[model samples]
Target: MTALHPPGARERHALVVRGGWDGHQPVETTDAFIPFLEDHGFDVRVEESTAVYADERVMGGIDLIVQVNTMSTIEDEEFAGLQRAVLNGTGMGGWHGGIADSYRNNADYLHMIGGQFAHHASKPPEERTGGQSDNYIPYTVHITELGTTHPITAGVDDFELVTEQYWVLSDEYNDVLATTTQEARPFDAWNRPVTAPAIWIRQWGKGRIFVSAPGHRLEVVQNPSVRTIIERGLLWAAR
Candidate 1:
């Protein structure tokens, strides 16, 4: 086993806790950004359990937390400790369910993060020349006028992507950077279009919070625009 922080000249400390439902490819998804973080001067510590959040000694020293776990349970102590760390200026960031959909029963976690994954908009199966995938829909993300000036989305153009269109339950507190629209489908009765945040930032006391609704799939996370947004978000969120 490796110590949380190995002896070296590492400037920043990042703890990546990845575990939970594998449908999201937690390990593989987190792997995509590990190299990028390391190359950018962070000593990354990867763990497969949420217990790391309970270690106050370790949590206190961490400069950032990159979680990839989805729909997992976290104890109160663990959640509290994690919250304290972020409140004290340790940055927290993640994508998809890792941060948004995680700990569905924990309201503190949700409030701190400023949003929760409500559901993915359902799309009717498409009739194509070949075949179609279930629950996956194609949509375009529009960078908000505000996003054009935010460091995380600056210079990044609106782009089209094929994945789950996450309809997040967000609040006014979030500094929304980007958004996507969900058009009404035959099966659903909303009868109108709804727009949701695709990327956002929040503040927890002295800490910085960043969340991107991409990363449902490795391919989505690998998209040039998506990846760039995530990379910049991480850097911006780090303490």
Candidate 2:
């Protein structure tokens, strides 16, 4: 897909805040995007902490904020500055636990993110063998009708992947782009089906927010389809 901003346009600044639980590979996953963002004409700045958000001038100057911190706490002042920045039109985007499952205790943060991780379906501990890894599940993600025409998802076909399928607590405010079906699993045995949004975008004040729920593993992030969706989403969310 073509970039939303043409070459030779003024450079857009992007800030990537990464750090929290190491299990999320915050640094590694976020590092994968620095070059991509730079190649797309963004002046990228990566920080290992949210302290940058406390500086109003810095936050105000940024065009996009890609946060990859998982399960971390944000100071009141820092979060307030971020809130003001986005409200003033700094776009925000991230995937999986980075954005969706972060700052668990911060209700205001969750409100801006539009969703929070509920759980990942996994086999009951008792049913698992030693060293078994049953948390990963294979699933298919279908692009919604709206996605067919949405800039971030246009021309992207439905794809299959095996990863941690997250069931999130989401709001109707999100413009859902794609979805996955959660069928009965031994982890939470029940004869029913539930649908969860796999990719979505929304507006907060003048800013745009984009999220994808399939980036738990490096392979997932490296997948052609997933990478394309995210790359486009970043551009779409930029100011």
User: Which model scores highest in TM-score?
Assistant: 2
Model 2 stretches astray by more than 4 angstroms: 1-7, 123-132, 186-191
TM-score of each: 0.92, 0.93
Tens digits of per-residue lDDT, candidate 1, 12-93, equal 9999999888878889989999888887778899999989889999999999899989999999999989999999999999
Shift in Å, residue 37, candidate 2? 0.8
lDDT of 2 by residue, 1-239 (tens): 34545767998999999888786788888888888898778889999999999999899899999988888999999999999999999999998999998898789999998989987776556756643156776789999999999989999999998778888889999999999888885546656888889999989999999999988856778899999999899889999
Which candidate number would show the highest lDDT if scored against the true structure? 1
Clash totals, every prediction:
0, 0
**Weakest 10 consecutive residues, lDDT, candidate 2?**
124-133
lDDT of each: 0.89, 0.88
RMSD, one per candidate, in order: 4.1, 2.5
Q: Which stretches of candidate 1 lie over 4 Å from their true place?
A: 1-10, 125-132
